[model samples]
Target: MDCKVKLWEVYGDRRCLNTFIDHSKAVRDIYVNTAGTRFLSAAYDRCLKLWDTETEQGKPGFTNRKAPYCVGFNPGEDKQNLFVAGTSGRKIVQ
Candidate 1:
């Protein structure tokens, strides 16, 4: 529960590639887009963030009163930019 998100290399050396230290609380969920250009992270800090895969820079996206539990990216090409976040408040937000 260090409130950090990590990226690891799948090939060769097999070491951590980067660490995202943005959340103030434990990160509960993460979703990566189909093309892997972006990702989303939901945390118990009651915040959701969007990140650039290559740059590792993140910006706040959603800040609900309730903590977010999960996140997912839209798979359809027509809605590729859309994503959803499910919160502990029992609501799913887009």
Candidate 2:
């Protein structure tokens, strides 16, 4: 329920592929990149994580004092360092 990410593939039938549990609080949002190889997840733990779709593992990405609500990766190829995350504190962290 909390601090978990479920991977599902809906090709012909519904099936859960895997689940990732690393955060200490509920995961708020998940954002897949354009490549579809990796994704970003925001959690109530006030942290952002980067997860590999293949490995099904998450690595600590970013963090702040306020709880993170949403996250998005930079679509531009050369702008990977410029990601954005919205927090409950009424501000967007870059």
Candidate 3:
């Protein structure tokens, strides 16, 4: 998949919640916030995207480094300002 994040409502009938196509390459990893209100995605396209879970909408949130292999929200103290990402360059960005 070159660029797609398919949010599915696995509860009940199991269907799509939303479809986000912001990356130009395969999305490598996804992470959710502790409160469940938001989430983030890192992709091979060297981009990170943040989503408002309740509204099913998103925006490009982070970028500037190499393509990432993983991304996650940081919880507990200072959580709102902290996010983590792992890149193929063998470095972690926070």
TM-scores of the models, in the order given: 0.93, 0.88, 0.86
Model 3 misplaced stretches (Cα beyond 4 Å) = none
Arranged by lDDT with the best first, the candidates are 1, 2, 3
lDDT of each: 0.89, 0.85, 0.81
The CA lDDT at 15 in model 1 is: 98
**Models sorted by TM-score, best on top:** 1, 2, 3
Worst 10 residues of 2 by lDDT: 77-86
| Between candidates 1 and 2, the lDDT winner | 1
In model 2, pairs of residues that clash are none
Clashing pairs in 1: none
Across residues 1-94, which tens digit of lDDT does each residue of candidate 2 receive? 5889888888967898888788889899998887777888898888899998978777766889999888998889777556788889989988
Error of 1 at 47 (Å): 0.2
Q: For this target, which candidate reaches the highest TM-score against the unseen true structure?
A: 1
Where is model 1 more than 4 Å wrong at Cα? Answer: none
Per-residue lDDT tens digits of candidate 3, residues 17-78? 78877777888888888877788988887889998878888875688568888887776746
